[model samples]
Target: MSLFWSIYVGVLVTSNLGLAIFLYIYGTRVKIPIEGDGTTGHSWDNGHLRESVRRLPRWWAMMSLTSIVVAIGYLILFPGFGNYKGLLGWTSEQQVSEARVANAQKLDQMFARYRQYPVNQLAGDSTARQYGNRLFQDNCAACHGTRAEGGHGFPALTVNGDDGDFVVSTALAGRTGVMPPWGAVLGEQGVTDVANYVLSLSGAPHDAARAQAGEPRFKETCAACHGAEGKGTKALGAPDLTDHSWIYGGDLASVEQSIRDGRTGHMPAWKDRLGEDQLRLIAAWLRYNALTEREASIAAPVADARR
Candidate 1:
């Protein structure tokens, strides 16, 4: 603290403590004059009530003295007195630092057991999954929904066929996917045609004539990132065009805007914020959810056949 502020605080503290001490001492020792009726010359409600002075109660006096002593002791042993470092030389920052170190050590011990298993295998462990789910909710749930179902402008985690290693690596390093604008090159009509053709790839509704016209153009231009079959390249983070999944909406206008204006999607790297073990835990939970969804999908077909 600045010298002026420190001295100001010290003065304020000393003045307050002095006033309290003075009040305590004077209150107990000072005597007040009283009438023969033993009441002070004060009354209310047509003299039904009258004020009287009495000695300070013994218990109240003792408690007040104790509180004063404790306050002085606290000031001497702690940093309450302005810039005094205190006899113990303790600091709030030091306390927080020590707490963080202790917490990290405890986490390390817990994660040690998890290190033995690969992320895929770790997904099968209920305890690990519980931790993973909590971690995912804390870190990943904002972009990927609580259920990992994704939202507009965000890819769904559950549907991605990514394995644990891929998930972990991506989380650690991050990824950026850029779809360059083809509006100027493709012209207005060409943009509409290509959008329709892209929709056709996913079996979404589209004009047949426009789709046919845009096929050659799509193969020539878009096939580099989105495969000729429109299945996407995972390495490039290009979403699979053949699937129902759409980072933006799957509607016709949305697809046209994407082709014309382009889109950029970013997944932030977590290496600085989260350790590898924590990332692996998140990957494991995601894998578990994906597997569970796949199993349910498979069973639904079998049950439908029986019905």
Candidate 2:
């Protein structure tokens, strides 16, 4: 608090305490005239009630005095009298700092054990995966779905069958996925044709004539980042156009807009935020889930053949 406010508060508290003390002393010592029947010269309800002066009860007076003493002691030892940090120099911030330090110390021990193994190997560890899944839910579930299946613009952690390394590295370093605006380069019709062609790669519904018209244009312009087959390059963070896993929507209008205005997907670096060990744990969880999905995909055909 400012000096003015501090002094003002101190004066207010001191004045209140003084007033309480004055009231207690005056209440006990003050004498009043009494009638012969041991009642003060006051009556109500046609003399059925009469005011009687009585000494303060010993227990009540003692308790009140004790409370005053306790209040004084509390003010002296703790922060109540403005801007004073108290005898022990305790603060809410200091308490929180101490708690965080203790929590970090415990986490360090757990992380040290995790550091001994690689992320892929750690994915097989049940206890590690459990911790990782919890961390993922807390941090990543907002953008990536609860099951890491991804959302409208957010990329999936495991859904597209991406390797653990890709997810871990992306998290550690961060990435900005930018599909530049092609509206100026390719006119509105060209943008629509290209969107249709891109859709055809994934076998989504598209006008055959429009796809044919844009095929050559796509090969010339987009084939560099997105391969001729539209498989996409991992290094470029270019999404696989052939899959149903569309970062943006798979609809013709959505695809056209993507081509016209373009899209930018950014994944914030977690190296500093999560640290190495925690990132590895999260990567392990993602890998384990992806592996499970892969296994399920493999088993499905076998089970179908048996049937």
Best lDDT goes to which candidate? 1
Candidate 2 clashes between residue pairs 3 or more apart in a chain or in different chains: none
Q: Best-fitting candidate, measured by TM-score? A: 1
91 Cα displacement, candidate 1 (Å): 0.2
RMSD of each: 2.0, 3.6
Can you give the lDDT of residue 83 in candidate 2? 91
- For model 1, what is the C-alpha lDDT against the true structure? 0.91
lDDT per residue as tens, model 2, 179-214: 988889889999889999999998899999999999
How many clashes (backbone N, Cα, C below 3 Å) per candidate?
0, 0
**C-alpha TM-score for every candidate:** 0.93, 0.80
Q: Candidate 1, residues 1-307: lDDT per residue as tens digits?
A: 9989999999999999999999999999998988889988799999999998788899999999999999999999999788899999999999999999999999999999999999989999999989999999999999888988889988988767238998898899999999999999999999999999999998899999999999999998899999999998888988889877789989899999999999999999999999799999999999999888778877987999999
